[model samples]
Target: MSSPLVFIDGDQGTAGLQIHERLRGRTDLTLMTLPATERKDVRRRAEAINACDIAILCLPDRAAREAVGAIVNPAVRVIDASSAHRTQADWTYGFPEMTPGQAERIATARRVTNPGCYPTGAIGLLRPLLDAGLVPENHPVSIHAVSGYSGRGRAGVEEHEGPGAVGAPSFQVYGLELAHKHTPEIQRYAGLARRPIFVPAYGSFRQGIVLTVPLDVRMLAPHADAAALHACLARHYAAAAHVHVLPLHQPGDLKHLDPQALNGTDDMRLSVFSNMEQGHVLLSAVFDNLGKGAAGAAVQNLNLMLAQ
Candidate 1:
């Protein structure tokens, strides 16, 4: 049989460009993309999506929805890199290590929704603890994350690096309204009964993210401590190739975490730092926002779907 055709729609944006780079020169599948002139032609775009065996969409939420709606081929599968379908029941979430059998679910799914960059970190840290019942469902959870400017896509790049851009701030925190889109995804996948407070920030760097969720030991399930939380996450991701659970930190063992440490790579590191005397525990995830958070994740889900 001929090689399966893979189409990347909207490959001009930041996420799209990175995904194209990662999948370029592959021998297993036939890569396809429309000429720049025809990229926005609705008919042409629809045709390209339907012609491929698998379509990877890296577009804005509305455009991603439109692309999926235009698919007329019954055999065409999709991996959407937008927030459009993440909370939808019919779409399979594409975080392979989120839980047992999640990878298999993506492999067999016809429509898969790539998790948001921030949600990827938040859910990665929260899911296992919630699943193990070490944390109460109604605990007041607050998440804080800082990501490279690339998380804002091409616009951010232009603001920080383009000509005539000279006075951009070094750091800025957003989502002050408490209605950030990733909140729902984190709550649902992390299995929380109540909504959590999510605050995200953008740094001047090109890519990477450090997302942290602080917890109060006194509010957790009885007998649950920092060690139990660490062990639970360690056990959950024991066999996961992409997700790493770092050793629990002791006093004076580690001082700080650099968000850009994982730039250019798809691996994500999860760290648990605690102060028992103060009854405080902090969970953090470090990864390239453009890699594991976006393009890397889309490529990952694409690989799983291709294995079917």
Candidate 2:
């Protein structure tokens, strides 16, 4: 059979550019693109979408939706790297290692929605615990995460790295309005009945993220301890190709957790830090916002879909 033809819908944007770069030189797929003059032409865009064996969408939520509406060929599968369709029933959530058979689901899905950066870490930490029944569905969970400025995409990059940029703080927190786009995906996929309290922040750098969730151990079922929670997470991700669980024995001496530790690679590291005496535990996940969180993930899902 011939190599599969793949089209990237928004190939000029930050995430789309990264996806295009990652797919460069791949022997199994052919990358298709339209000329700049025809980039916005609806007919040209629709034809490209329909002609591909797989289409990866890295546009804004609205544009991604519009691109999907233009696809007339049912054979062209899609892997969307936007906030759109994340909660839709017919679309498969694109975190392949989410469960035992999730990879297969992504491979066979006609439409797959890539998980957001924040939700990638949040769901990675919470899903196993919730599935093991250590945390109830109605539990009040709060996630505190910090990302590099690249998480803001092109405009954020221009604001921070541009020559005339002004008033850029070393670190800042947002989402104070309490309604972040990733909350619904986190809540839905993590098996939480109530919405989570999500607080996100951005730093001076370009990429990577650190998502931390604090939990009170005493409130857990059967009075579980910190080690139990660690074991649950470690076991769930033991076989995963990208997610890694750090050992719990090395505590106190460890200095700090850097958000940019995994900037260029498509890997996520999860660690559990606990103070049983204080009855608290902090679960942390570190990854590249543009890698495992976005473009790398989209590529992974595309590989799965094409394999099918």
Q: Each candidate's root-mean-square deviation in Å?
A: 0.7, 1.0
lDDT by residue for model 1 (1-308), tens: 89999999989999999989888889999999999899989999999999999999999999999999999999999999999999999999999999999999999999999999999999999998988899888878999999999899999999999985689889999999999999999999999999999999999898999999999899999878999999999999999888999999997798899999888988899999999999999999999999899999999898888888
TM-score of model 1 relative to the true fold? Answer: 0.99
TM-score, cand. 2? 0.98
Pick the TM-score winner: 1
lDDT per residue (tens digit) for residues 195-251 in model 2:
999999999988999999999887777756788888999999999999999988445
In model 2, residue pairs whose N, Cα or C atoms come closer than 3 Å (at least 3 residues apart or on different chains), thus clashing, are none
Model 2 misplaced regions, further than 4 Å = none
Q: What is residue 142's positional error in candidate 2, in angstroms?
A: 0.4
For each of the candidates, give the backbone clash count.
0, 0
TM-score of each: 0.99, 0.98
